[model samples]
Target: MSYKKVSLIVLGSEAALKRALITVIIGGDEAAKSSYLKESEIYENNNYKIIYTPDLNKPSKDIKSVFVYNKDHDRSLLVVKEGFSTGEVWKQIEELHKLTGKSTEEFIVVLPLIHEHTESYPFTCLKISNLFSTISKMAEDRRQKATSTSHADHPDDPMKVAGKPSDSRVNLVLLGMSGSGKSASGNTILGKTIFPSKASSSPVTAECQAEDKEIGSSWVRVIDTPDIFDDDINDFTKKQHVNKCKELSEHGSTVYLLVMHVSRFTDGERNILRKLGEAFGSKVHEQTLILFTRENDLMQGDMTQGAFIHSLTPDLKKIVTKCDNRCVWFENKAPSSGQVERLMHVVHQMLIFRNNSAGSWWRFSR
Candidate 1:
């Protein structure tokens, strides 16, 4: 008895598959070229051939070989071939699945996008290696997501899950007066020019907005709130914005950054800490850190940061003491990663202190 080799039936029109095949063959070495020809021949003869069909065609004979479908139809097997130099492959896969409006199988593979002009083996190997790395990372992410979802579906406790929280996210809320560099501070924290900042008497950020970013094993979620305590804004609107900030804090622990300009300290700021305690709980001071913007002013005055902060006005010093002397300075004109890193260090310390202290929760007004 003789056995015939099984060929893969790619789910696509013969013409389309052929064009893709030619592209790949032209880009590969002699060995890969020969393999392509052999695979193509197998598709030509149904005897031991691969089949290329636009749809899943019903056949009289039983073909036990692998069939590649052009589009995912909730199939058990899938091989996603993608080639792009930029963006994320994981994101692209998700987008395609959503665009198709179909649930896809977990069994998947990703092939690199081959360049037709490339002939060097070293370059080709590097490309293949990158593709495999991306696929592996995607697989690991999927596994973690599945595990988390499983635990979420079957909760063992009312307040917490059985396992430790997998989220390594930190929420930083920017709170300050109008034109106090709060919006600019938000952009600095996020390392992006998202929040609009300009010279205006009115608040630049009228509503609470959030942006997320990752920083070395931790995800930093930056929330920019309006000048809620501004006298110009009514109590009703202030409460609404405050509530929005609280909502964003639901997913993770919160660190409030009370932004203030280095050069400009208005009368309103004199009672800011007291008002903050009234708005949030009395313990709000523990979660709040004073962030002084416009470090350039200190430089211009030829004053060291420590001396400048130490020489703050009586009211400002009192507010800093209320926050346990936790403060950071940023140059809104020249934002730097160093400033952000220093701030994150302070944030990390606060989180540790909170975790260690019992019955210490971020005080957010209901």
Candidate 2:
């Protein structure tokens, strides 16, 4: 999709500036809606609730749901159909832009659908899949911009900065045994090879290293730490590592990615969760997600990742269950954007959950 189309769909209208609904018009066969819904399963699998609506007249206010609609719905968002009048669309989009001056609504998305028969309409159209992909991305950008704007307008008091998060970046601390793919995981999260990763019998990342990247609309900082909880590691060294992790996370909303080899469950792994609580605090599990590397191991066992996880021993199961069953799989040797996108999706969810919790920004494991 062209940047112009994205801008038109998102920032084209004054009414749309404060709009909640990200309206998309899909054009295709009679199965366009079904195809769109089928494609949306990817979003659903990532925990994004997608609401399918044939009628935009009665839209739901479900804040957690991303709405998908078809049909020629009259929405305030700018139109970008072929044969559509560019002058009229711009005029309407500009008018819609005015509605966002002091808008606080955060839940709205309007998507219309035009049959392929209308293909010759002047402005070209994207298929439902591409349309949704483009719109979904634009929506994220809109939210992030809105959030930054909100923060800018209501800056945190200097006195409360110590108690509150002055920065919105999501700090992702990769914690696990050395050679557990912590470095590779960090590289994966950043969608680049910024962190060094190699096969080593000894500890590779002796000290903590951090790198930041802007994913979606938020900044995510990935901190690769040594296996500080390892019994072989000296107490003084472990303590320093623990303090460093805390220092790096002091200013942002933090989520720990507990990296582990998918197939290697050593004795050290059994008590790792408990040790994590000791190093940080009992509530550390609330902000942690288990990230299993070397997914090929599970494949070797003729098992799916979910099945392998469920089939873990009671001790391992306990650790996984403690972190709200939040887990992700990565094949470090090869990295893909889809994998990073999924991981970031989880990170974003963790940040949202933390911010929504009472007083503490994070909720203790129940």
Cα error, residue 56 of model 1, in Å, equals 76
lDDT values of the candidates? 0.57, 0.57
Model 1 RMSD in Å is 21.0
User: Model 1, stretches more than 4 Å misplaced?
Assistant: 1-167, 355-366
Tens digits of per-residue lDDT for model 2 on 36-150?
3321221121112223322221222321122223122112223233234545643433333343321212212222222123324322333322344455576655444544343
In terms of lDDT, the poorest run of 10 residues in model 2 is 39-48
Worst 10 residues of 1 by lDDT: 357-366
Error of 1 at 287 (Å): 0.5
lDDT of 1 by residue, 1-366 (tens): 122322333332134333343222121112222123223322322112333333222331211222222232222212223333323433433443454443333323223322222332211122222332333344345445545343345354322333325354688999999888988888887777989889997667888998777653356788998887778778888788888888877777788999998898899988887778777778898898889998998999998766776688898888877786777789877887667766775676576545343112211100
What would the TM-scores of all predictions be? 0.53, 0.58
Every candidate's CA RMSD: 21.0, 14.5
Candidate 1 — what's its lDDT?
Answer: 0.57
